[model samples]
Target: MAHNQFELLKQRRFLPYFVVQLLGAFNDNVFRQAIIGLLGYMAIDADDKALYTQLAPAIFILPYFLFSATAGQIAEKLEKARLIRITTAMEIAIMTIAAAGFVTQNMIVLLVALFLTGVQSTLFGPVKYSILPSVLKPEELTGGNGLVEMGTSISILIGMIAGGLIFALAGAQGPWVAGIAVIALAVAGNLTSRAIPPVGAGAPELRIQWNPIPESVRIWRLTRKQLAVRNGVLGVSWFWFVGTVLTSNLPVYAESYLGGSPTLYVFALAVFSVGVGIGSLLCEKLSARTVEIGLVPLGAFGISAFVFDLHFAQPVASMAQGLTVGGFLAQPGSARVVIDLAGIGLFAGVFVVPLFALIQSRTPKGELARVIAGMNIQNALFIVLAAGVGIGAQSLLGWTIPQLFLALAIANTLVALWIFTIVPEFFMRFLSWVLVRALYRLRVRGIEQHVPDEGPALIVCNHVSYMDALILAASIPRPVRFVMYYRIFNIPVMRWIFRTAKAIPIAGAKEDPELLRRAFEEIDAALADGQVVGVFPEGALTRDGAIAPFKNGVERILERRPVPVVPMALRGMWASMWSRRDSRLGRMRVPRRFRAHVEVVADAPVSGEQATAAALEAKVRALRGDAA
Candidate 1:
C-alpha cells in the first residue's frame, strides 16, 4: 500500500507464499546437495557412478510431470492457505525421511525421498502461483513476482552451499542441523500462510483426475485458451529446460575440464543464482509500476551474450589441481568466468519474473491454482527434455562441456523465438520499450484494481503531462485507445507517439467540432465491442496542476454505449519534467527522484451518470488520498 519496495513483502498475503516457497527451495537443494555429496563412487563401477549421480536431479523433476495436474485439482477443491500449511507440515516429515536416508546410506531410499520431494513441490505448484492474483491487485503482480523470484534463487544458492558444506563436514549428524532448519523454515512459511485472506476455488465440483499424462494434456489445453496463461506456461518450461542443462553438466565442466574440487560446483551455482536474483529485482525497477514485458527480450540478449562468453572462456590448457573455494577465486581468469555465469543468472531473473506475473494477472478467476498446475506440468516435460539432451550431447554426441553450453545458449534463443512468435503479444511489448525510453518511467498504484480485466469499460483520467497518453498506453495490460487533443496529436515527433498507440484525436466545439463527434463515435464503437476507451474528460491536458472540470463529452459517450466507468488520477505529474510548468525555467529546479515518485492511482468504477464532474473530481481526490 505504501508503494515502497518492501511493502509487497511486509504484507501478510504475499509473505506466506514467499516464505513457504523460499523454504521449499532451501529444503530441495539441501537434500539434493546432501545426497549428491554422499556418493561412494569408489564402491560402484565407473559407468554406474555417472548414471547414478545424474539420476538424483532426474528423480526430483519427474513428479512435477506426474502429479502437477492432480495437485492443481486438489488446490481447487480445498482451502488453499490451509492446504499450503498442511503441505508445509508434510515437508517436515519429508525432510525427516531424507535425514533417515542420509543416516542409513541407503541410495534407494534417498532416491525415493527425492521423488517424494518432487511430489511435494508438484502439490505446491498451483497454490504458489494461483494465490497471487487473489491477494494482490494487477499492478502488484510484477513486483510480487520479482520478490518471489529473488527469494527462491537466493535460497536455492545458499541452501545448496549450506547443504554441501554441512554434509561434507558433519557427516551423518550434518543433516541434523539441516533437518531442524528446514522444518523451522516450513513452520515459518505456514505461520505466514494464516495471514492470507481467503479466496474460493474455481470449478470446485469438477472431478479430480488420477492420471497425469491425460490430465496434463487437458490442463494444457485449458491454458491454451487463455493467451497470457499459455505464454506463462511456455516461459516456465523454457526456464526449466535452460536450468536443467546448466545445473546437470556444469559439474562435469568444473571437475574434469577445469580440474577443480567439488567447491567449483558451488561456485558455478552461486554465480547463476546471483544473476537470477539481480535480474528479478531489476524487473520491478525497470518495469516501473505495471508489468512492462519489454525487459524479457533484454534478458534474452543477456542470456545469449554471457552464455556464449562462458563457452569460450574455457582454457586451452589444464588448470592446477585441488583448488579450494578461495583458491578457485584466486585462480587466473576465474573471476571473468564467474562473472559471466552470474550474468546468465541475472538476466534469467529478468526473463522469468514478468512471465510468471503475466500469467497471474491474466488467468481466469478461481482457476488460478489449476493454471499453475498446468505450468508445473510443462516444467516437468522441459526438464525431461533437458535431461535427454544433456545425456545424449555428453555421452553420445561426445560434445565437450563448453560446446554443450554453447549449444544450450543457441537452444535458448530458438526456444524464445518459438514461444514469442507463437504468442506475438509477448514481443508486442516493443511499444512499451519505446514509451519508457522516450521519457521517465511511469508509476501506478492500484490502477489494475480499477480496470476490469474483461467486459465493456470507460476509464476517465485527468491528463496532466504530454506523456500521459503514452504512459496510459504502455502500462495497462489491456490495449486501450486514448482520446487526445488534436493539436498535440498532429505535432511531428508527438504525432508518431500518438500514431503508434492509435489514439483518437478530438477538438472542442469551437474548433473542429466534427472531430469531437468522430471521437465519441470511436469511443462508442470501442465500448460496444467490449474494449476500454480512455479519455481525458477535460478534453485536454490541464493548464493548471489541479484537475480541470470534467466535460459532458464523457457522459455523452457513455450514454451512447453505457458501460462501467473507472476513474483514474495522476499525482506528482504537475511537477514532472515533461509538465507544462516544467519548461526551461524549471528544468534545473526539480530534484532527481521527483520524476520517479509520480503515481497514477485508480479507483473503483461508478455508473455513467454518476461520472459527472463533481463525482469524478471526488474520485480522483480519493485515489490521490492526502499528499505525502
Candidate 2:
C-alpha cells in the first residue's frame, strides 16, 4: 500500500531484496571488469588480452544456456528467500575461487571462476524477477520493476568504473585489491540476502526437472501459453539483443568515432546508464503507479528515434585522434551524441520495465519462475545473435559503426511494429493512454480500495460522453471488458481500438436480437473467466448533463454471472467535446475546455444478489455527487 515507489526502498519488504540484487549486479560487473583490468596489471600482450576478452563473455554466458531450466525448477520448488540466500552463499564460494585466481594470476582458474559466477547468476535469475509479484502488489509492479532496473543500471556502471580503476590506481597491488573487493562485495550481498524476509516458494510441490534441455524446451512452451506473456518474453529478449548490440560497440564507437581513449568509452557508457536509471525512475510517475504497457510503444519508438539520430549525430569519423574525455566533450556535436546515447538507454528502460511487470502479473505464480527461466534462455540466444549481427555487419559487410547504428534503428522500428501488430493490445493501450492523458487530468477515488483485485467484477457507471470507456480504461488498473453501444464500438478509427481492447459491443433487442444475445453471452463468459466487465447502466449517453434511468442490462448480467458489482461515476466529462451537450446540430465543435479536470470515483462493491440496476445507478449518482 506504499503510494510512492521510494517508500518501498525504506521498508524491509523491498529494501533488503533491492540491496541484495544491487550488490550482486555490482559484484558481477566488478569481477568481470577486474578480469579485464588484470590483463594490464599482469602486462599481458594485446593479442592474449583480446583472446581472454573474447573467451570471457562466452564462458560467463554458457551457464545461462545450460542450467537456466534447472535453475527455474529449483527456484520454484525451494522457498524464495532461502533460494536467494543459497545463491548468495554460492556467490561467496564462487568469488572465493575467483579471488584465488586473481591472486595466482591464472587465466584458466579465472575462466573457471567466471563460468561458476555465470552459474550462480543463472540460478538467481528466475527468483530475481519472480519474487517481485510476491513482495509487491499489482499496482506496485511497475514502480518496483522500475526501481530494480534503475538499481541494476547504476550498479553495473559504478561497478565497472570501480573495478576498472583498481589496476590504474593501485599499480602492483591491483590483483590483491581486486580479489578482496569481489570477496567483500560477495559477503555484503550475502549479508543483505539474510535480511530479505521469508517469501514462500511459488510452487512448493513442483518436481525438480533434472535435464536442462528438455526442461528448457518445456518451459519455453509454457511461456507461450498466454499471448501477452509470450510477447512480453519476446520483448524482453529483444531488449537484451538491442542492449548487447549497443553496449558491445561502445568501446570501439568511443575510441574510433569520438576519437577518445578508454576513459571516454566508460564516460559514454556512464551517460547511457544514468539515462536508463532516470527513465526507470520516471516510469512510476508516467504510469500513475499502474502496470501501464502503453509506455512500451512509446519507449519502442523513442529508442528508434534517438538511435537513428545517433547515426546522423556522428555519421563521419572524427578528424582528431586519441582525445581525452574532456577533449571529446569539447568537440562540436559531442553533446548531441551524448544525448542520443542517453536517450536510447532511457527509452530502453521504459521499454523493458512494463514488459517485465506484464509477464510477472499475467503468468501464474507457480509457473512464473520457470517462465522467467525460459525468457533467460531466449535472452541468451538474442544476446549471442546481437553479437553475431554486430560483428557480421562490421566485419563481413564492412559497415562503419554509424552505418551499423542506422541499421539498428531501422531494425528496432520494424521489430517494434511487428510485436505491436501481433499484439495490438500494446498499441491499443498506447493510443487510449495518449488520448486520455491529452484530454483530461484524471483523478480517482475509492478504486484501489473498492475494486476487486483478482476475481471477476462488474463495473456499473454513469455514461456521460463517447470517451467514457476509454477514460475508464485509462483510469482503472485492470483491463476492463467494457460493454458499449455498438455504434460507439464501430466508430471509424475508434472501432479498431475498441475491438483490439476486446470491448463487448451490444445492440438493443429491437435493433438486433442476435447481437444482443451474443453480447450478453460474451459478458457472461468474460465474468465467468474472472475478468472485470464495465457497463454504463444508463445504456446511453446523457443528453442534458444529467444521469439517465438505469437500464436492466446490469440486473440481467448479475442474475446470470452474479459477480461483485462496483458502482463508478465519471464527473466533468459531460461538458467535454465528446459529450452530447452541443451535438444538436450533428456537427463537431471545438472543446470548451482543453485538458479538463476529470474525476472517476467508485463506491464500495455491492453483492451481486443485492445489486439491482436501480440501486447501482443510485450508488453511481451518489458517487458523482453534484460534480455534473
Candidate 3:
C-alpha cells in the first residue's frame, strides 16, 4: 500500500497505466487544437473556419454516443492490459490517417480522422477508470484518482499549448509539424501502453452485444442499479457539463471582458488548469487517502461560490480590445477574475474525483467497465446539452456572458442540493467528516491490515461518546452499519445523519422488546447481505472513563450470523465534549479540547465461533491500553 499518491507514480503497477492515459489525453487535445491551428494555414474565410470549429466537436463526440456500449462490452470481455494496448495501437493507426489529412490539407479527411479518434477514445474510456480499482487498494482509490485527474488537467493544458504553437512558430511548415507531432505522440502512448502489466478482465466470461442502441440502454440501466452508484455516475456527467460550459466560455470571456488577445485566453485557461491540478493533488491529503464523498458537497458549493463571484468580478464588458496578457493583468479587477476562474477549477476537481472513486468502489467488478461506458455516453449528452444551453441563453434570451455565468452558479447550487437530497449519504458523510476533523486529529493503526475490504464482518468497539460511530466511519475505509443506542440515534439534528447512514437503532428489551427484536433482525439481514455491522459491546456510552462490562447481545448476534469479528478501540474520546463525563456532572458542556489527538486502533479478526462478547471486549481493552 502506497501512503503517498506520488509513490504510485514511481511504481510499475500505476505509473505505466497513468503515463499511457496521460499521453492519450495529450494526443487527443493536441490533434484537436492542431486542426484548429491548421485553419489559419488554409485558404478559408472566417465563416468556413467557424463552421469547422463548430463541426469538429460534434464529430469528435459522435462516437461516444454511438459506440460506448459496444466499447464497454469489449473492455469487460478482453484482458485489461491487452485492451489498453489495443486502444493505443488503434490510436497509432487513427493518428496516421489524421497525419495524412494534415499533409493533404483535406478538411473532409481530417473530419473523418477526427471521428475515428473519437471512436478510439470511446473504446478506451471504460477501461481507463475501471482498471484503477483492480490495481489500487480501497484506501488508495482517492489518491490514485487524484493523481490521474491532475495528470489529465496538466496534459490537456500543455497539449493545447503545444499544438496551438505549431502553426504560430513554424508558419509554412506548420502542417508537417502538426502531422509529425500527433503521430509521435500516438507512438509514445502505444509504447507506454506496452509497459502496463497484465490485469485480468472484469468480466472475462461475459458475452458481447453487437447491437449498440439496446446495449447502450442496458449499460445505462446498469449504472442505475445501485442508488449511490447511480448518483455517482450522474455527478460525473454533471462535472462534464460544468466543465464544457466553463471552458467553452473562457475564450470569449477573456476577449470580451478581460480585453485580451488569444494569448490571454490561453493564460486564463492555464490558471484554471493549474488550480484543477492543485485541487486534485490536494484530495489525497484532505481525504486521508480514503474515498471521502464528503468532499463532494464542499466541492459543489465551492464551485458555485467562485462562479457566482466570477459574474460580479467582471459584470461589464471591456471597452479595450486586443490587449496583451500583461496589459490585461495590469488592469483593476483582473486579479479577481483570475482568482474566480482558478477557484472554480479547484472546486471542480474536488467535486468530481470522489464521485469517480465512489462509482468505482461501490459498483461490482463485473459491471464497472460497462457502467463507465454508460457514464461516457451520458457525459457526451451533457456536454452537447451544456453547449446548447449556453448558446441559447446568450442568443435567444439576450443574456450577457456574465449573466449566463450567474445563472450557471445558481443552477449548479440547485443541482447539487437536489442530488444531496436524493442521496443524503453524500451530505451525511460531509457532516461527519467535518465534525470528526474539527474535533480530533485522528490516527489509525491496524485498520488497513485487519479490517476486511469486502464481505461480511462484525466490528466490536468500546463506545466512549455519542460520536463513536461517526468517528469510526471516518477512520475506516469501508462503510460500517453501526448498532447504536436508540437515544443517541435519535438526538435532534444528529438523528437525520444517523438515519441517512442507515445506523441500526436498538432499545433494551425492558424498554421495547419489539424494537430490540427488529434491530437484531436488521443487523442479521445486513450481515447476511455481506455488509459490515458495528457494535459497541458495552451497549452504552461509558459513564466513567473505564471500559464497561461486555453484554451478551454480540454473542447472540454472532451465533445467528457467525461472521468474522474485528475488535476495535477508541482512545482519548472519553474526555471529549460529547462524552458522558460533562453530561454526568449536570453542568453545561463547554469545549475543553479542540482538535484533540485521537487514536482508533483495530486488532486482528477473531473467528465468529471463537469471538465471545467477553473475548472481544478484552481485545478492545488491550488495543485501547491505558489511553482511555
Candidate 4:
C-alpha cells in the first residue's frame, strides 16, 4: 500500500540512511558557513578575508571534478552499507583534523581540512544516490527522493543557523565550539550509517578504474546510451547551475537591493528552504503517488514567473543602512518579495525531485552509480561556471543584483524551452496534465497496482468523449501509446500533443484502408517492444451518454498479438465540456463550466485469449456503474 513519505522513516532500510544523509548535509553546511563567517566577519585583513572566502567554495567543489569518477567505480564495486560506513568514518577523521586547525587558529590547516571534507563527500555521492534503487521499489522512488530532498534542504538551513549563531556568540572560543559540534555530528553520522541495512554490490564484477579522466569520459558516454537518461542528467545539472546563481546571490541581494540586514537574509533563507520542503512534499500528492514528469514543466513555468516577479519586487535604491528583519517585514512591498522568493524555491523543488527520481527509475541498476557520477561531474562544472559568471557580471560588468535576476529569468526560459524541445515527452505530458487538471476533477481507483509497470499490455476502455485518451494518458503512471482516431488525433491544439506523444492515428476501413493497416502494424511493433497500447473498443464516442457496442477490430487485434488486457472506464465524462453532451458546436463548445467531477476505474488484467471485445465492454460498463 502507498503511504506518506514520512512513514518510510519508520522502516529499517530508509530511516538510518535518511539520518546519515541529513547529518552529512548538516555537517557540510556547518563547516562551510563557519569558514565563510570567519572570513567575512572575523578576519582582520580585508584582502586575506576576500581571497579565502572566494577560495573556500572552489576547494570544496574541486574534489567532485577530480574524484567523482573513481567514487562511482568504487560504489559499484563495493557493498553499499559497508561503503557508507567507511565514508562516514572518513568524515569523522576529517572533522578531527578540522578541530586541530580550529584549536591552533591556523588558516592553512583549516583549508586542507576543508578540501578533505570535500573529498569525503565526493566518495559518498555515488553511494548515496545509487543505493535507493537497490533498496526501494520503483513506485516508491519518487516519495523516497522527495523525502531526501526535503531533509537535505531543511538540514542546510538549520546547520547554517547553528554555525552562525555559535560562532558569533562564542567570539574567540567560536572555533572551539564549532569544532566540537562538527566532530559530534560526524560521529553521529557514522553511527547512523552503521545502522543501514546491508545492500549487495550493484556491479560486483566491475573493474576499478584508476584514472579519473578516461573514466569520466567513459561514464559520460554511458549516460548518452539512453536519451531519457541523458536528458534527465542534463536537466538536473542545469537546475544546479540556476540554483547556485540564485542562492549564492541572496546575501548580497538582501543587503544591496532589498535594504536588509543579516537577519533579513536569514529570514529569506528560511522562507526559501521551507518552501522547497513544502513543494517537495507536495510532489507525491500532485502526482498521485507517481513520478509524473508533467510536474516538471509546471515547475519550470513557476520558477520563471516568480523569478521575473522578483526583479520587479526589489526596491529601486539601497537604503543608507540595512534594516533589521522586523523593519524589513514592516515595509509595504516586503510581503511580495517574500512570496517571490518562496515561489522560486517551491517551483525549484517541483522541478528537481522528479528528474532525480526519473534517472534512478530508468537507468540500468548495474550502471546507475556511474551515471550518477557523470551527472555529479556535470553539476560541478556548471556550478563553477555559474560562480564565474556571477563574479564576472558583478565585478567586470557592474551589474546590480536585480539585473542579474532579470538575466537569470530570461536564461531560465531559454534553457527550459531547449530541454523540453530535446524531450517532447515532458511537454506532451505537461499538456495532458494541464488539460485534465483545469477541466476536470480527476479521481482514479486501482491504477497503481493493476497497470503493468513494464511490458506489453492491451488497455481496453469504453470511448466516452473526445478527451478520453488525454485523460487516460494523464492518469496512468506509464507512457501509453494511444490508438486514436485520425480525425480526433488531429484536433488543433491536441494534434501536436498527440503527435508528440506518438499516439497512433488510425482511420476506419472505408475512410482510409492503408492507415488502418499501418496503424495495426505500428501497434504490433509497439507491443513487441514492450510498450502499453490503449484502445477504445467502441472505436468512436457514443452520440448519447450510453455504452456503445464493441467493434470487431478489437477481436482482430487480440488474434494478431495476444497480450494481457486491462479493462478501464472513464465515468462522469459524458457531460464534460469536451463530450457531446449538448452538441460539439453548440452549447457544449470549447470552454464549458470547469472542474467537473470525473472518476476512472481500472480493473484487474485478464488473459488476452479470453479478452473478447464483448467481455471487456461489459466489464467497463459494470465498473462505470451510474457515473454518467
Candidate 1 residue 30 C-alpha distance from true site, Å: 1.7
Report the candidate with higher lDDT, 1 versus 3: 3
Clashing residue pairs found in predicted model 4? none
A best-first ranking of the candidates according to their lDDT comes to 3, 2, 4, 1
Q: Least accurate stretch of 10 residues (summed lDDT) in model 2?
A: 585-594
TM-score of each candidate? 0.82, 0.97, 0.97, 0.92
| Model 1 misplaced regions, further than 4 Å | 41-48, 172-197, 256-259, 314-318, 441-457, 462-467, 474-532, 537-552, 560-607, 613-628
The 0-to-1 C-alpha lDDT of every candidate, in the order given, reads: 0.75, 0.91, 0.92, 0.86
* lDDT at residue 82 of model 4 (Cα atoms): 99
In angstroms, how far off is 319's CA in candidate 3? 3.2
Better of 1 and 3 by TM-score: 3
Candidate 2 — what's its lDDT?
0.91
Residue-wise lDDT of candidate 3 within 461-500, one digit each (tens)? 9989888998899878888899999999999989999999
Give the alpha carbon lDDT tens digit for every residue of 503-572 in model 4: 9999999999999999999999999988899999788888888889889787888898889989999888
User: lDDT score, residue 508, model 3?
Assistant: 97
Q: 399-473 in candidate 2: lDDT tens per residue?
A: 998999999999999999999999999999899889888888888887877887788999999988888998888
lDDT score at residue 574, model 4, on the 0-100 scale: 80
Clash pairs for candidate 3: none
Off by over 4 Å in 4: 37-44, 134-139, 199-201, 552-561, 584-593
TM-score, model 2 to reference: 0.97
How would you encode candidate 1's per-residue C-alpha lDDT over 1-628 as one tens digit per residue? 5274469778766765777788788878877776666664125676766787778777887888778889988988887777887787777777777767766667787788789888888888788778777777666677888888889889988888877776567765664655565556656766766666666665678788888779888887877887666876787788888888888787777777666787777777788888888889888777765677667777776887888888888543236666666776676778777888889999889888888887776677667778888878777778888889988987999998789889988888887887767666566564546555554546666665668867788888877878777676666756678888898789777776576556889898889889877888887888887788888887677676777777778778866777888888777777675667665664545574244456777888888755676687678767756531
Q: Candidate 1 overall Cα lDDT vs. reference?
A: 0.75
